[model samples]
Target: MADTVSPRPLRRRRMAILVAALAAVTALACWGAYRWAEAEARAALTLNGDLRLGLYASSIRNAVGRYDYLPFLLARDHEVLDLLDAPSDLRRDAVNRRLETANAAAGSAALYVVDRSGLALAASNWADPAQSFIGHTYDFRPYFRQAVETGSGRYFGIGVTTGLPGYFLSHAVRQGETLTGVAVVKIDLEPVQRDWAAGGERVLVTDENGIVFLSSHAEWKYRALRPLPGAVTDRLAQTRQYDRSDLPPLGLHDGPLMENGARLVSLPISGPEASRRAFLMQELALPEFGWTIRFLSDLEPVKAEATGAAILTAMGILLLAAATALGWQRRQTLRLQREARVTLERRVEERTAELLTANRILRDAQEELVQAGKLAALGQMSAALAHEINQPLAAIRTFVASTRLLAERGETAMVRDNLAMIGDLAERMALLSGHLKEFARKGPARVEAVPVARAMDRALALLASRLREEEVQVDRSIPPDARVRGDAVRLEQVFVNLLRNAADAMEGSGDRRLTLTATRNAEGWEIRIRDTGTGIAEAHQFQLFDPFFTTKEVGQGLGLGLSLSYGIVRDFGGTLRAENNPEGGACFVVQLPEAQ
Candidate 1:
């Protein structure tokens, strides 16, 4: 009878344990699903940003190329017809023939001659030969106004009478400041729209007033454009490229639209002739014209995938909870029997031991991760630093060899020259050592009044060996007593970094010269290090001062020289910038506050 009573309680306890386990597993699954969904959304946003920037750049380049060519066409057509004195019936007939030839040659849809009154006198396509155009005035048209103003070529958008959506290339045919007629070439919008719509995304080309001039979807063509519904429209409007205001109040969001439920990304194209600040929701631009192209991508498929993953994760968690509940029920009776002898202190001790073991493992893992990060950073900088130090080291070796040879010869004059070289080399060595010391120097820097010329001298001294080794001539134009308030050591470090960088830049060049100039500006003192070395590519200018980013060979530098130098200058309330010099090579400018 006791055994039977125990079995009954055991069965009830097992059922209770099963229910609890199922609930826990279900909750865990739901949590995991939520986290995964959030991550997927973040990843999608990142991908969108990268793709938008790349495509936008490519499209802008293409548009600029096309726009530049349009001017050439206008010039060519104007030259061909400018030889004619006056508009005669026979001459008009010849002009019509030439217009057809020019249109075909220029790949333009229509070529025509319009009088000052905006009447079409001759056209390649004479489909609608209207006598009314001869007296009709087009002085209000953009192309007409531009031609009259500039006395050359201009671009104009489509108008109501044109019937076709396109841009016009027009040039004023002037006979000694007297405007005779306008030579116009029309470029149909279909080709550009077709090219832009090649990717599997909706594309819209619009005018300044949000009029849909061209679109991949025919339904949208000629339609009055409306803002896409949902947070995406707001995101597009809030982008720095479009909206100039700080940021939108609601911020940006990613997802399907409430109206059509289509996933999309909107890009704005801004171009000239459009309003000064018109925004395009597309992927292309005409910088000269200030036109923008907008490209939108649908996100439905990605959403579907995310939804499926979330559902699967939830189901898996529910299954895990069910299994846990079953296991818990099986141990309920045994656990209950043991509970009678177990005390809270014993359980606490067991838990404490488990926690201690986990903590030890975690601490070991964290230390390893930190060490790995340091090694990675070191690896990146090794090449740049080696190159930096190698130049001075090589110079020191050369000076030593030269001095030894002079000593053996017993030529006093030659020995003096060699001795001077040795002294210069030693000063450079000191400068380099100072730079290394500054890079490794941590904590707050010691500030003091330092003569600007002295700081420049120290930097020049540090790079002298390298400059000599690379055959780079240095011209210093620093004034005496040019002092500034800063840490002497840190200021020297800044100069050393800049001078070394200039030397490295001129390593393999024929015109290996560096110019160092300092002058007092309105703000304070400005030091310029200009070199005739390989100029920096526009792409790499911004990344030059980033820590551990190097363009040097392996084991030569750590890419930290400039980055460290930049920090040191900034700490003393100074600014450092790099730019491509007009004559050749690159220039680094360091500006500091005047010393009291």
Candidate 2:
């Protein structure tokens, strides 16, 4: 049912397609070669510019270092010291001659000394009366104020005396605690600019305020790289950083940018050359002096190579495009397959992350159980607190009854004293309650040095009534000077818990003695609270300090006391241990490092 075409016409069609492809590929190869040559030329230019900048920066650093050295040397001179001690006119000439000789030897533009009043007392150029700095006041200058206040300073300005732009390095001359005067070395910074100009390279140096003070291009000097704030502009005017010159903003259009180590931003140069001007702008930071150095290279010079590249490359692009089309199609297919697999893997990762988050939630729920245990420990302390307050209240009730009898007898002074005594007892009860509330509070998770005797005294004061009521023989052998590093309140709690346990353990014993002993060894501080009772049974001794393990009757204690105490000690880089003493008592020993 199909019409069969001649084989010769099909062969002719295939030959025509092959010939067209060959022609296209040949054109593409020629275009690629031309473009490659142009890229190589631009790369060479970038490398050459970078090398030149490095050399120039190195030379600038070396020159800048010279200005720093001369002032430090001049400040220490004996003649300069003498002039600062006494700004007498009789000493001025000798100081000037010595300065002039030193200035010439050191290659400084000028060397001068200013008094406390900022008046030039002596100078190296005193021989030329026209250019002499003597008797001229520089109080308006930043260098004068900086040197007096900071002991060293640097400033760039135009000289009022010589009318020359230069950098002034200044140091304070001190005479035993008093600031006497300033020693200054003025150095001309123009030679570097001159060298740059001679090489036909444009460079600019700007201060922290972005005001240009040095430049190879004369028109750029005294211009601001950025818009200056009103206050800064006024300050500069007052200090005369640029003398009477009106500083203007550079007004650069921040558009295209390229970089290697240098950020090349295009700056539009105004005037007749503005239309053809395109410059490569880069900056280097002089962090020590809080200044910036800007470099500019004109792109107009490289236009010839670009033009030639375009003209040569235009002849061959279509051919290369035809030759690479098949390979490009195959590459696109492979990329699509890879992307699909990556998308599937990313979905798996997202699901895995969700699982990990669920596991974290489970871990957090487990943590809630531990916090509940801490709250339960607080609940257990409620009984001890009530017992502590009950004793004080009982005492207060007896005092009140006694006071009523004293009032009826008209023993006015005795009644007053009893009332005062009642007040004291009330205050004591308040302090006890406050201490309990604070002890149970979960605030201020911090630790500090805890003095052993002081903390023990606090605990003993709380338990004093209990001990007397229980007829407990208390033998405390703790030295006043012993100290340990821990949370003071927590350490006090440890002692309170130990004391309460001691009193309870010795309840039925005939001889009830709570002996507290504290001693310092080379490693740390050791404290022992020993209660003379029917000592701990052998079976319970091993689990004495474990959580929820207690020898006392249920509801009498939380079993968390020793467990929490052990944890607190461990957290403070210490240890707590319990053992039945050989001398017939249960002893709780706490070892803590001495406070650093």
Candidate 3:
């Protein structure tokens, strides 16, 4: 009787074993389903977060780039240059008006010009007695120092005068080769942050040092994501980047990394365990601006979804085991299992629809960014391109007027000549328009062996009327073999710019002489255009070739002549420079490499 063991007791022991086995299988199935669902959910969230992060970065970049051209453009203004050249009450008044108007039009927080010594000469806020930046010295500011050192600079910090946080964009203002002053435009980025907050997005932007300067949450501003090094802290202090703001660590703890460089992070709120919240964090780098953007999505929903999936899986497994053990209720168990599967499928379908919506939104954002970029580029090149075509248009106007007179006088030969000249001018205008497109695109210049004398002759012919009007005595001295490796059309433009500048300089001078001399150098042929006028100021000589650097009044030039000429010559493996001649005049030297 096996120690008097009852059959009922044996059956009960067997049933207990079977129940234990089913429970173990159900638990294992639940864990597997939870892990699989969690992984899938994290991957989807990271992908979607990456797209949102990119869109945020694009918006910030576009905002910064939009104002990048403003400082340089304002620096080129004649009134701003005048204020720096000769500081006077009247001139300051003019500049104040100018800056105020420009600031309003540009929608910048403030616009001001600081002399080389960092003294504020004129400001847009001159009217605001409380916030006027006039007479302040900003030499200690890194933005001013950097602009003086480099051609341009950007900085983010609290304003010393206004005590408000803003981004500073500065450009070195030059009259010829001299850095006379700095043109600064202070932009308030609070609006951008406000937009993020309005969207209810958990986003933050950190500088190179990991200190959050902009955020959707106001409490996160000026806080460090991690413990900052001593050196970085010291640098921030020196720059006054945050201006007396305390940068405490956010105590971010990393948990596990997911696909596409996203990861789980736990941040403490206030309490012990209840205060901790998990976030799926994704970061995108704005390399151009040396900034990082983070997008945080709450993980509570994902956890809930994974738990639901696990529960469904566990229930199905238990029902299948029960069905196998109890043959009578097998049909009912199967029906329950099918209903559980249908519920799971419906949830999955809902998730798929959400992902599709996210994808469409991202696509639309990318398209908008592309279109905005295209429009901005067109706007920047429009002014320079217009300047290039204006010269030919003016000449055409004069020729057309003269042709009308000749036709009325029955001078057929002269009229025929004028029509041919008009045709040539039209062709030149077409070529100029095409070249401008290439220049804007930064396409390579057309390289060929170009005759220097012939190019100069064409340039002189184009400016013949201007030279006559100014009563300039032109002299040319070039060897018969004055040929160089260059683009003929571009070289002609360079010559025309130099000659036009020389004539302008000789204006109101007693002795107006334009002398051209060419000589061979070790590198190439050196051509000098000397103008007998009040020679360039010693201060301006160094910046003569810099782009948008001009001494002429506004509307007369866009300060692109020498800069464009320098680039064209460099493209042909040549050099362009300016200096004061020993004999009381300004001289321009263009050297081109010898023909191969």
Candidate 4:
């Protein structure tokens, strides 16, 4: 006796409701599965990226530290070169003893003493003693040339003698600034190769000409290296990381093909000499030697996992929809109608909430992405900046230490001059440090009154230890009464930076002399720093104050010191200038308003 209904219409209505429910469930399940897969993939990729980068960085640090230590080791054993200069028979005995001692300490393959003419006079290994190497010419060796010409040290590739892959670290033996001979130490590449193998990564060490001298993989040993296709080789020439795209497709497996209609992610391993565009994928630079390391991995398993998850989600949705349809069929007609309306309303509300949540998450992710980008940029700048700052600092330290030694030895006149140079160097360092701090700061400058001479003194004091080690001469001509009304800290910083620059200018030059003169002029109190070293080029004078305009080698100078100092001086009512002195050197002049 209930309201009569056509069976066909009822059946049609039931089918429509079941279909709608099934579709809704399928869409939700698919979306959830997609999000889950995306999250997992992102996590895995991030982890992989971190692990590879960490390993690369650690390896580079080790290499740099090892190389830096080489010079010190050679300097310590300088007496061996003298021993090799004796009669051939006596030289052989002394040289062998010294070689054995050095070999024991340095774990080197062989230690050889080469004469001024690049003749191997003595050998370390007893099996091939000095007699075997006596009169053997090595003028063709790069390390020998570097030692004779540069009068410093250099790294050379494997030798023709042993036929084993190695590096020759050569130091010049100077007799009062005259190159007497060279001390060559041979370091085998086997240990470093072993290190690379243990790290689960392959490393190929090449020279400037792309000739591979050492490789972790034995098969690649002594191979002539070619650029990896698309790899960034410039930074790699020092140290760097590239992703898959940065490299040629020759050596790597293809990454996972993304399903779920999302964009595919390709990992790039960059080469050492890649370009800026080449770093579109993940890239890091090694500013030291321009070397690059690339990391690549397969992503097929990730794609398969995502695809399977999507299919499983679709099947689960179908089952859920079937259950929903059965529940609807079991209900009374009136109740079924009521429940259907409620279900549709609930689904709409739930969808709206999900959309809102997704929007918020997307916004958060965007912000995080921006911050990450900023940090990455900062990381790239850090190495170059540190290197630039360190050079001046090292120089300043040398000058300061020299001044201290002069003072301790009761050499008042020399001490005074050295202190002045120390002060100047300190000012230069302070300026550099200030600029670095400001560059990294998120705020404005804080100014205060600072005494000029006191600032200079503080700068000198900071470098006291290093100056003594280098035995550089310093001359200060500033009156103790000099003072400047400005941001005391910043004023000192400027002077320190300028002084440090002067000290750096004298590095490696046998005649290390720095002169500082401070006097009251019509404009203000003027301080001039002069160095007796290779003068600046006339062409580069204008660009000296430009940011990142350094004439130094990679990682040596950020070229921001003069620029920052100029800004600071102008802010505090001062002037800074530079010029080539008539006496074969460079001079920097700083003028600050006299304290009222």
Candidate 5:
């Protein structure tokens, strides 16, 4: 009875095993390579474009510096210095002649001076019929006030005399400690504008007030990026900055932040040269001057990169297929040699081996679902990082003001202490700002042995001010020696987000309590964060971890905290469970495998 199987049965089993393995390999090749190829190609293209943009931004920053050098020299000029406090027609003429010579030599629009009372002292174009500003008062201008108050100011505006827009560079004219007047130099941006137009590349530079000071496109000049505040608009109009120009906001579709963490927008234009459907835009901030530079890139290079990746993927699949076919052919030859002597018992054994291999393949597919869910949840962490950073920044400002008052009162020792505290606050803010970039958004998918208690401590430290503000009570029972396989910072982010969410939920509740409890079992360690507040609503519970889903009112939240935290935990090979507590609040449980 045991010898009932025939040689034909043995051949069929071998064929079945080969077919299954081939199908599995084929599916893996097609599915995996597509995603890998696309991501790699896109990343490479993006990096290239970003590098190019960074180069141009640096150039503009340096250019601004170079253009201001002569204005700084004019501030220190002996002729201009003498005319500040005492200006007569004879003295003004001498200063004007000297300024005119320098302005022409330096290729500036004009060089002028203003006293503390805002009266125009001298001008480089004093003799020009249509472009002289010899006796106008510009005390109402922001640049005039900024230079008087802060020692230096840079502003862009249309000249009342020349009727042309230009950047005004002003430096305080001070003899010893006594302030006298401001040395003003108007720089005509024509040189930069010409370069931008000739380069055939889209370039835009917006000032601190969000107005476009420089752009290749004529229509975009003097346009605003954001709607100007009414006060700012009135000031601009009163100062004659744009000189009767109606500064409208630019039209565009705003996009997500780039890898470098800058806002951007796509400006659509139609022409023969504008072949790309839409521009890939990026904004680079000139933090020193409170300016933003934006560049729009063509899509041809990225398309080429994508094409190359597809070709490579196809070639790889074909090579793999050929190699696998060769391997099967050789294996078939060897099996055929033994076919003549194959027994009924061996045929039954082959069938059992094939079934076991099939079972193993199915188990692996289920494991990949965890990674899929984590990826789906990762898209919402960007705004969460911005939200977390605000708290630390607000604290830093408080510390700085306190430190300044102590210093002014000659309390040096206390001042030093507060300064150190402020530094700590600043570092904490930076850490919060970078967490999204380093932990979730840019982190490689992996797990590591992490100190569970240390992560909890860090999260608690960040929420210290919030906890005090909300008057929330905390109860902790986590063990100091507990460790798990996960990323420490990311795990800390998970707890920080959870704690903050709990604080928001309990904002006005009378009994605001947060409980942290940890326990270990055969499977792994479990951490529970329970809050005494209104639990998540039944209808919204399922979507709690979905991207852009929030239960809070508009402007209160971006609905990203729980989703980001969920993704972080999942990426660490852990489970993040959310439910309504029996005690009348929300409970989040984090389950992490114990470190080997």
Candidate 6:
């Protein structure tokens, strides 16, 4: 056995060990908190950066695409074609003035016409005394060569005459099969740069070759994002794309890799000292223009926030350790915790009961609303039923008066015919009443093969007196065998509703014409009812088929005719739509599927 150690020395050694362990744990906790906070902050920054990247991409695309149609449209202008077809000073002057006006209106940098040999025939800047593109020859430009070969081309380069940069859009002008010339529109993209500069975020737009053509920072423009190969540099020089020889690198150094393909990068700020800063870099591609957009988010604020979180975490760990050393105090409050738990349980039960009562009340209110809707629908159906019967009643009165006059003259044949017509009218009224009752019950309509011609004839016969009173000219183009799958009585009711609406629409019109046309399609038959009257209001077009929607005066309609017709057509597996005719008036189309 070893010699006995002193208690004071042993206790002191154990205490020292404990203090070392605590210090290590506290440091580790703080580091973990800092890492977590920095990661969370970077994730948020990446999300926001990606959003800004997309918006910047869209702005660039819209700015460039707005001028895309200019070149193609101007290529077909007669003046441009004439100037290309026959070169003359007189025609050239006329075209130059026309182009100048168009350029100003379109807000393009320049508009010019080039003939087959790539000679500028006329330009928008022909009147510019300093330097005009009128006499400039662009046979060597890639846009001119490409347009001649492929009928159209697009390129971005520095203008040789003006020494200014622009995006060039070209379209080939053709005469019969021969290529005549090319129309070119130059668009200035500096406004887009200015817009980006106004925003707080830093943005850079680069082409396929990694050359930054547009940047929020003017100093970054024309700088290569990466090292350029010999071939790329040669091509750039040949095309005169940048109009600069000393193309410096942006010196963007990659840092740590990030989630979602985002990464950390160090960018050099513009100054004599050339200080560098860390950025969370995100990239988005604009495939339409074969360009890439980069968004840079500063990370200094994120670092500061993480540092503060680390300090708070260190303090929390110290407090947690102290609480652990004093954990025996929790035992003293066990009885009080049990009493509080019981009280909480009782309160929860009371709240649950209250919620159940509220739910029952809500259900009862819902039932009441449903019942109120049913009653309203019944009222609308009653109004629609009366409106349907009034028309036949008027016609019956007219026929009955005619029959009495004929009977006095002893024309038994005419009286018999009038009696038969009255009987038919009475049956029709009864049928309509029955159908309306069925509709109120939400029952389906009877389906069968109904002839379109017969339906039109019956509707027209019913409205003959009204048509005569309104002096309406009826035109029919319905085929004899044109039929559809639907309930005949309901179908006839549809036609009557449509015809009455048309006639009413033409009430005060100088020319009252009702055109009924039916034609066969691949799937079924399309029947159109058109009226030469005041057209439907644009504000009410979409709501025509909605229940209780109407434009008629009081007592004239129940606002249920179109709604009922639309439902009837839908029940037959068909569609009914209304539109304002381009010529005048309104047209209602009913499309029904073909009968097997």
TM-score of 6: 0.55
Candidate 1 per-residue C-alpha lDDT over 278-395 given as tens digits, one digit per residue, 9 for 90 to 100: 1112245545554555555433333444454555565555445444544555577877635622543464465556556645644453343222111010111223344445655665
Rank the models by lDDT, top first. 3, 6, 2, 5, 4, 1
Model 4 lDDT per residue over 87-178, tens place? 35765666666566545444456777777888876676765543355567877666677777886555544345554545557788766766
Candidate 1: which stretches are off by over 4 Å?
A: 1-35, 38-42, 45-73, 76-85, 126-137, 151-162, 174-181, 194-200, 226-290, 322-596
The better-scoring model by lDDT among 5 and 6 is 6
**Which lDDT values do the candidates have, in the order given?**
0.59, 0.72, 0.81, 0.60, 0.72, 0.80
Q: Which one is best on TM-score?
A: 3
Q: Could you give candidate 6's per-residue lDDT for residues 1-596 as a string of tens digits?
A: 89997999988998799789988998998899889877876676777776677677767776677679877877887778988999999999888977886676566899999998898889989999566888778878888988999988888777889988889999999998899999999988887777677664588889898888888899888888889999999888887778765678999999888758998899889787879999888999877677889988888756765665676676666656655544534455877656655654575565556555545654453343222111111212344566578778988999899899999999999999889989999998989778767765767666788898998888888888779878999999999988789887778888998999888889989999988998888769999999999989989988898654568753455467888889889889999999989999999999999776
Better of 2 and 5 by lDDT: 2
TM-score against truth, every candidate: 0.40, 0.47, 0.56, 0.41, 0.47, 0.55
TM-score between model 4 and native: 0.41
Candidate 5, residue 110: the lDDT equals 85
Question: What are the per-residue Cα lDDT tens digits for candidate 5 across 1-596?
Answer: 57587989899998899778877765666556555654554455456456656766765654466458655666777777878867778888888877776565455678888888878888888897677887788888778999989998988788777788877888888989998988888877666656666556677888878888788677788888777899999877888888987888776667776565534456656586763245567677888778887777654444444444444454455456555555555566666635523543364465446445534533342232111111111222334566566655766776678788988899999888778867876776666556555544656645678888888886887677668878899999999778999866568778888988888888878999999998998768999999998998989878888754577763466556787788878777789988999979999999999988
Tens digits of per-residue lDDT for model 3, 352-433: 5655664565445334323211111221233445656777788889888989999999999999998898898788888877
lDDT of 2 at 85: 84
lDDT of 5 at 236: 79
Question: Which of the predicted structures, 4 or 6, would earn the higher lDDT when compared with the native?
Answer: 6
Between candidates 1 and 3, the lDDT winner? 3
Clashes by residue pair, model 6:
none
**How many residue pairs collide in each prediction?**
35, 3, 2, 65, 0, 0
